[model samples]
Target: MASSLTKDSATPAPEKTFLGHPIGLATLFMTEMWERFSYYGMRALLVLYLVSGGADAATGSQGGGLGYTAAISTAIYSVYVALVYLMAMPGGWFGDRVWGARKTVAIAGSVIMVGHVALALPGQISFFVGLLLVAAGSGLLKANISTMVGHLYKGVDDPRRDSGFTLFYIGINVGAFAAPLVIGTIGETVNWHIGFLLAAVGMGIGLLVFLLAGRTLDPKSSQVPNPLTPAERKAVIVKGLAVAAVVAVFYTAVTMAGMFTIKWALYPITIAGLIIPVAVLVRIKRDKDLTPGEQGKMSAYIWFFVAAAVFWMIYDQGGSTLSLFGDKNSERSLFGWEVPTVIFQSLNPLFVVALAPIFATVWVLLARRNREPSTIVKFSVALAIVGASFFVFAIPLSQTAGNDTKVTMWWLVLIFLMHTVAELCLSPVGLSVTTKMAPQKYSSQMMGVWFLAVTAGDCITGLLGLAEVKMNGVGVILFQAAAAALAGLAIYMYRKKVDALVEGTK
Candidate 1:
């Protein structure tokens, strides 16, 4: 099947346009929006649900939580999120070599829906199983969808490309914003299982949209970019099985020795998160078929990837650390009704929805004037801005320490606002630059490679959660802020060299 698909020629760009871009963008946008709705909805509830003690007899309230400590819950959260992105490598590989992006996305979405359904079922075993399934599905879906968006453009230099990505980004945040408001409320105030069920419905809608409208997409997107030979397929399967077997054996040995607590088990994932990118870099560098320009661009991409990882390491805390802070440390009263902590999760995506168009327009205008900042510059600025937000947050946290006084929820709002701005500077631009930088044969795989930044950052965020248990919140925030700011400064100092390596990609 893969060999047959490889014979098809690249499809021409569609004549139809959605808001002056390719019509396929609309299909992808709706599909991704609903996919995110499912993902973010579940995420908003995960940590809180894990730490919840079920059914307080005094209050006659029912809560079916796992009763895990914050440290354990956060460790689990980190590993889950990290694995979600880490799986993107194989997802992209499957899209490029086996099923093609269109079919891969369809398969992934179905798996995600089943995962959510599993979470909706009763039992501790089912809950863990659900998480594993969802993470695997998300990893498979994430990169391929973004790759399809890149396919909607003429080329990397298409004037519409960045704005298209920014618009697509808005779709992502729209789902993210709505998910918490809808799913978070249900999960926190009502039955958690019902909330999980709703998430499955969202994925169902996403899959339906894709199946119905997918033909409008670039026909080439449905063709395997690089089909593997029969021998290569056997080799890949054998290697994959061997690795899985090794991991299973090691984990079994640790469990037998009584050293396999959840926190301890996560160490391998954390190490792999750090190591995989380095290995990928080495692999890309050794690709003898790559032109000098592609090699140089890959070099620049490494710095960008590191910067992005740092950015996500902080930004992703909204689901874990910040969610806990909202629950325990913030004043949630509004007109005598206490707000759900998970509702606060909506703010970042809300800001993104409100801000994306403005940023998109600004970039287009700047490009017209030939004054658009380079991707490296944008990344540096974003890092510093995001770091500054943590500094601002630390100020308020310091004042409220050692006392029962809770800070106003407005502080979190302020932080999310800053994060949205910083995200505008980096995320969409990162997507655009990635598509611009990749070699044709390795296109989808490179998109998967790009997501490794998120994987590494998320892994670090989990590790930091452990530290946060021992240290005061202020100290952790301060340390993270300093690290981010220093990274931004370092990138700024080397911006010229990085830009040169990009070879005029912007």
Candidate 2:
């Protein structure tokens, strides 16, 4: 699977530079920054808007919400986010084999802008349509734009590659950090639709930047790496339509049967999320192209995948469970002015921006001393730290149960800080390991496999939110904390076996 990321050694490097890297870096940086602004901006409001009741006729209070229950709102949020990631696989495929990276990104960005516009419109039909469009568009744009960034570098061994990615990463967090403050404030205080319109404007700016400056990007990025033959293209179209037909028929049948409630709708998605990864792993293991050593590494990668899924299941609760808690249970008063709940959503990215470099330096210092933890150990530590963060929250919730007391905002801040630390340990290392351990023949597909972990984790998070609503919230948090900690311990117990299977790839 040749990709835009794989540079041709024979091609000459570009001479024009920006910030000591290719000039195209700036184009991509700005584009991704604003794209994230749109994404996180809307995300900050999604659940809050869904659960809000616009105004109480009796009390004359200001409110503009759909008034869905917490469980339903969380479930919708989970499905929306899960589908966003799930689209990455096909998005990458379209970039690599059909439209090429640059074109796919340009088209996808346009779609995303339109999606945001739809979201800004009034009515439930428009809201649902907007979610679908944004998910589809984001799926296409996210992976391909990152691919374009890699294309800017000369090759795998480019000395500036890591630094370039670091700069690119900062763009992501910058957008994420700023979005909630700007969009959240407006959405919570004024109108949710207006906030969504602002998100549209953000994406529009990204698209304009990309369109004007994209020519500076590597020309190879515009070349389809594996152009399909006309016959193959027709076959793909036929297969796609067949799949769409099957889905439409199934949906119609379920709707007619009156078995298509929100909870029931989630069952199929959760089942698919659980099953797809197992099927992918089985297929990879059965591939005759892999050597026995590669097969062993595949087995080891499965462990890492499971650990990552567990990690994201807890970490992504920041948007659903954590956001809800912030809105309902956290004290928002500051100088007699109430703060918006969505502002707390900014904390994770804020911490990520601040802590990433420090963690990088620590890793380097540890490596120089030959005292760096192994990949498995780092993963175990991440799970434990994140789980413990929740445990920390659980204590406060348990003590405050059945009372009107609101916890201080500092508690949520502390949790975000801890989550950032765990992310640094696991997320980047997980990406590095996926590339290192994947069988050469299936490398591109392995990236898709990695994203499936996120999909699976999010699906599980939605299901757990329902459970949290039904059972005691404090008890559910304690159970999740215990489960995560035990998962970490299990990984540690089998560390030696995993290390052997990985065969020194790390």
What digit string (tens of lDDT, one per residue) describes model 2 on residues 1-506? 36644667557876788899999999999999999999999999998888777321112223666776777777778878888888898899999889999999999999999999999998877888898899899999987998898999889899999899989999999999889999877877789999999999999999999999978899988999998999999999999999999989988998899887666656677667667777888899899999999999998998999898889888888887788777777787889988788898899898888888898899899999998888998999999999999899896687657766778878888898899999999998899899999999998778888988888888887776555362227887888888889989999899999999998765
TM-score of each: 0.87, 0.93
Residues 327-388 of candidate 1 have per-residue lDDT tens digits of: 76788899998888889889888777778779978999999999999898999999999999
Specify the highest-TM-score model's number: 2
TM-score of 1: 0.87
The total number of steric clashes, by the backbone 3 Å criterion, in model 2 comes to 3
Error of 1 at 221 (Å): 4.2
Q: Model-by-model lDDT, in order?
A: 0.86, 0.85
